[model samples]
Target: MAPGTFSHPNSSSSSFILVGVPTLEAFPICLGILFCSAYVLALVGNSMVLLVIVLDESLRDPLHCFLAMLAAIDVLMVTSIVPKLLGVFWLNSNQIAHTACSVQMFFVHSTTSEESGVLLAMAFDRFVAICHPLRYRMILNRETIARICLAIVVRALLVMVPLTGMVTNLPYCRSLVVPHSYCEHMAVTSLACADPSPSRLYSVSMSSLIVGTDIAFIAVSYGMILRAVLGKESCRRAFSTCGCHICVLMLYYIPGMVSIYMQQFSRGVSVRAQVLLADLYLIVPPMLNPLIYSMRTRRIRKAMLNVLFPRKAHACHGGQ
Candidate 1:
């Protein structure tokens, strides 16, 4: 059992009941369908991205490798929350073991941080390719990329493990009913009998540090890329290359920022609204990432087509 989450001093175990959306409790069927559809789409789309990236030799490069990492993180992110969410909505199985809830909280936070790190890495790749085309390959070689990925994982673990640990260590003698879809950090912390200010302070500071630093670095990278491409004939191609990344960056950061800040700061925001934002933050990106990449990136699109429609791809190639 997680530290102080036991039901009683003599009780062997305890559980947290996940109340998905309190106001929408009467509409579980609708909410369940929506969540199920989104989960299936996210899984299929991100899985296809991973498959195509692995099978297709043309995408053997740093950009697609980062994309594969993002896909894997998205898969983990959605899987960690959605199954339990489904159980809550469909089977009325909202009761999650204390240890399991803590683990879910860790996975959710860690995967999100990893995704942010990968996005920053992707932005740097774009900057190098555009601003220093000749040095791109040498700068972001396989070894360097591998190290960057290792660093991202290490950083996420270092940051989130402690946050989850702090939450788990709190005395949760209050109501164990988490009022949102998942065991969100704040939602779990709210149930703590101890003052949750330390955990909240840690969470906010770490989140701001990660998001703020990544955004600043990405902005600087794009700033340099823009400066390099201005008035050059390659400007169009430069924007084209970075456009998909920018779209994805917006998809990720915007809702996430709103969700985090609103949850922590805004007294006017209702619980249902907060829950909706949190759901979208996790759901929309995973579902849209492959779709956006497939539509905007010709290589990924072609690779996907070749994988999914091999005969058609062969016929089209033969025609060309």
Candidate 2:
């Protein structure tokens, strides 16, 4: 390989090794078991949410519809990253083909962007419900929600395909061993022989722009909802309604922000800490979102019970 040239255009035949958390290399089995367990839990929990939504006709409304979208994204995000991680941890099968790595990269980023968009849409839904109760259905009907989801998908594809394409096309003439677990854009870009400034800059700018814009919109929505309900008799109830969403938003964004800062800006942060936080930001939320909704939302709780313990649900309903 020359000084400033790539080894190949696409490097489709090349393979990259994923060493799951270099600092935690000694505990591969433990880490593998841990993530495997979490992955199972996430799958089951999110699957149950989907199952209940499908089985219960009442959950077909806009709110549940958004929840369904969120659950699906969670599943996709984890599935894309975790299996490869498990292989690295347990089977010592860390080598990933370039093509497969690119696919995983695409799914990880696209799903994240889609999730952010969905969260913003959910915030808008809450805004309408709380601020314009009488017109909530009129504003967020089935057709409108469908269009919003379509737009989220389209935006993700437009941004992520180019991002992934650019990073994967880089000439990786150096070490192909990715220090982190999955095919994180910057981590893989670091292995390239050429200057990675462009990919790094574009990724950071696009991600910040998308996430920042979503956060700003969510804040404005909540602010309006607060103004609409302040000092009113329904104030407490209104806050309660939005509380679940607030908790979910915090879960999704706070760790994400911490991970990005630790990865890009902070020199004092340890690689182990950086890797752990990065993994958790993607893994923990999907496992917890269904639990949060099930415990907090009465309708979902009822629907879950009805699906999982039908006999008990029937007995309770009969007794009621």
Candidate 3:
């Protein structure tokens, strides 16, 4: 049990308090400002990405479509928790209702899984474009992209519904203070008086099965892409096109993996470190995804520049 206020055994009426970054006790105001800045940046950046893709018909290629979907997911992912996080840090209002926490957990997990699925889909797009250039248009048309997006959403819900249900259904008679920034599945389950083995097992198994499979597919797709591009004049171009995606993948997964390992296996790791990693896992990717894609992808770069400097872009276009 956590060392905080106790809640009733009935899960419906219970509440949890989020104790965000106790190590920042000395600089709560500074931490709040920093977090707020990151949140605003993520929201604005992702919104710009979505707007650019929607406004520019030329940016409707399958790859850019996937990128837009990813940006939308990042926007939702950060919005799901960051507002409450600010409440905790700045307002000192840490209490969150059990139901609200459950909702947060669901959104966090679902959006995260969807992001992984989208990345894998993007990898497939890259693979098709590079290895099967002639068939790319026929293979990844509008209908196919729509189907892929729908399937990703469905998969995320199917995997997360049961797992989140298991955690929320557990009777939490113990302390209800979650020593983290947001209501995570593991953190919430840890507060239950009942043995959380089922929740734990499901968390690990589902994550391994879903996210692991996505990573494996991405790896194979990139492997084949590499094989196809090797020793060819297009090698540099292909690699450059995929570089931004690979960086986003690393940023998204590495911190999450480390946080999970620490939470489940490494008992000696400090709570502060674990909490910090968890915050990073959620915050860093969304804030950087738009920036990375904009800077690295030529099409997105030009589109963004056009949006920012339409007169100049128009002059350049007329000159061309």
**What are the clash counts of all predictions, listed in order?**
0, 0, 0
lDDT of 2 by residue, 1-320 (tens): 63323344455347888889977899998998999999998999999999999999999878899999999999999999999899898889999988888899999889989999999999999888888889989999878988999999999999897788688667777678888999888788888987888878888888899999999999999999888889999999988888888999999999987887678778898878888999999999999999999998999999998998999999988999
Best by lDDT: 1
- For candidate 1, list the clashing residue pairs, or say none: none
Candidate 2: stretches off by over 4 Å? 1-13
lDDT per residue as tens, model 1, 1-320 = 35575564444447888899869998988999999999999999999999999999889899999999999999999999999998999999988988898899999999999999999999999988888889989999999999999999999999998898798899876567889889999998998878899999999999999999999999999999989999999999999999999999999999999999999999898999999999989988999998999899999888989999999999999999
Q: On a 0 to 100 scale, what is the lDDT of residue 105 in model 1?
A: 93
Query: What is the C-alpha local distance difference test score of each model?
Result: 0.92, 0.89, 0.88
Question: Which stretches in model 3 have alpha-carbon errors above 4 Å?
Answer: 1-13
User: lDDT tens string, model 3, 1-320?
Assistant: 44223466455345788998857756778888888899999999999999999999999899989999999999999999889988888888889987888899999989989999999999999999999999999999999999999999999999888987787678777678887889988788888878899889888888878778999999999999999999999999999989999999999888888887788888998888888888879888999999999999888889889999999999999999
What is the lDDT for 124 in model 2?
Answer: 94
TM-score quality measure for candidate 2: 0.95
TM, every model: 0.97, 0.95, 0.95
Error of 1 at 131 (Å): 1.0
Q: List the residue pairs that clash in candidate 3.
A: none
RMSD (Å) per prediction:
1.9, 2.6, 3.0
